[model samples]
Target: MNYGMVFLSIISNRFFDLLDVLNKLNELKLFTLFINIKEILLDLRIPKSKQMRTLEQWFEEYAVSHQNPKNKAIHYVCVPAIFFSIVGLLMSIPSGFIANTLKLNAPIIENWAVVVLLFVLVFYIRLSVAMAIKIAIFSAICLVANYYIGQVFPLWIFSIGVFVIAWIGQFYGHNIEGKKPSFLKDLQFLMIGPAWVVENLFSKK
Candidate 1:
């Protein structure tokens, strides 16, 4: 597999797990759901197009082909629902820790920083709903995992360990496909890794 596939697989696994959790929480209020969807979608880094209508039309077509007719809207809504829930839970942990350590009035304010960052990402990029959902899920898992890993191992050591493991999986996937890894040509392929898996899942459906 190539590095891209490896990165994508890890992200896919985490997102699938999160989807399981979101399925159980599908009863949230409409306004809350809309806000969460907006917040989570805001984290995509897609480049803008001069004609957004064309892009929207393309996405609509893609959605119809990839998503079940009965569940198309649900998929978009649920994907982000799962993503933001995981992020909210994971970020709260460190935010509480930081608040206690620094004696802050509102430790939860740290989450606002994350919110601001997501706003910047969405404003700059134009990712599909599925892509945004997958990225959000995987990014949250990586952040939480990295935090705990850093406590056990030095940051550099932990990073190197993850890099080695990730690369090995990636090369294995590439060996099966017999194609050059996407990352070798464009760094943005790094972001596409997770989205690719999500697309595959949708295609299967």
Candidate 2:
């Protein structure tokens, strides 16, 4: 894939993964709820029929190949969740710090900008209405988190440091897997990462 596509995949994968972890932590008992939320997301995106069937078959095979339902589910959820959480946490630190240092008089406006950017990103990925709504909810949560974190930290230092650290963690995860990352093949795979995890979770039921 092109460099821009790769970059988008990387960022999108990381973002959705972060949302997965945050959602999990916030509502462990409501895992199925998240699955329903994901279904809504899928509805909005309108994935290709052939690709959808292929993905479903691939996931079923993947689940069986692992031989442990729990492990499979954990793999689906934890890998992306941890990878993306680090990314989000890293990026947010710097963003938060920068806004603080600049004395951005209108934090709300900045947060709205971030939300709008997220919507654009999701749109670019061609997410469905349901998926868009889920992402909007996550973006809203991230904004609140960003505002609070910005109030507490210095932006430039936080941004650079977080980027470095999170990237290292990401590479480490890939190293263990010993495979070129999925986004390298298809940029849309980035959006699929979160839905894939949610699919695995629901597949168990």
Candidate 3:
């Protein structure tokens, strides 16, 4: 006679029916399909905070080692320079093999740097979409600059020169800060450094 009992019975029946369907899927050698669906449901049940670190959290940790004004100022300059140089170095690598292997015809997306940056963008996206977009814009600019520089000079040599000098400056700044670079603790902070720099440049806060 209870309405609540009727509702519970209906829900239980539907739940069991769904489980039976899932079991059939597994028996049919579609175990992967069942596992993927299970994983998706589990992922949805997990809270966002438990899934990944937020952009603010990454920046907060990065800021710990970059506290001193000298360190902060140096980072403002050196981070972008280091990022640019790495991109230039990547672009200098021949992409003919990658292009041939992938059967790609697009000139714009054929460079090694572009291929690498796509993965980098994925990392940024996992932290924050806004961060991803910002890094993408900066990466495009680096690509353009490297393109022009490669036309007139050896990009690999230029990148190596800038990379060495920038690291020297970075170490000096960290010495002034009296803290080690954040990447020493975890290599992921290497990617975080550029995001932190971009946030500082664009964010009013």
Q: Quick one: best lDDT, which candidate?
A: 3
How close is every model to the real structure, measured as TM-score? 0.39, 0.44, 0.72
What candidate 1 gets wrong by more than 4 Å, as runs, is: 1-125, 201-204
Candidate 1 residues 83-170, lDDT tens each? 3334444443445555666665743344433554376346325756555655556565645664555466664454554455555555
Q: lDDT per residue, candidate 2, 1-205, as tens digits?
A: 4999999999999999999998877777576778899999988774676355554554443333344444444455455544334334544432465466667765644433464446545652453555455545555565555556657885435545655664465455555555555656555455555555655454457
Residue 59 error, candidate 1, Å? 12
Q: Which 10-residue window in model 2 sums to the lowest lDDT?
A: 61-70
What does candidate 1 score on TM? 0.39
lDDT-based ranking, best first? 3, 2, 1
TM-score winner: 3
State each model's CA lDDT, in order.
Answer: 0.51, 0.54, 0.88
- What does the lDDT come to for candidate 2? 0.54
Candidate 3 lDDT for residue 142: 92
* C-alpha RMSD of candidate 1: 26.5
Q: Which candidate, 1 or 3, has the higher TM-score?
A: 3
Error of model 3, residue 153, in angstroms: 0.4
Flag clash pairs in model 3. Answer: none
lDDT of 1 at 3: 98
How large is the C-alpha RMSD of every model relative to the true structure?
Answer: 26.5, 23.1, 10.5
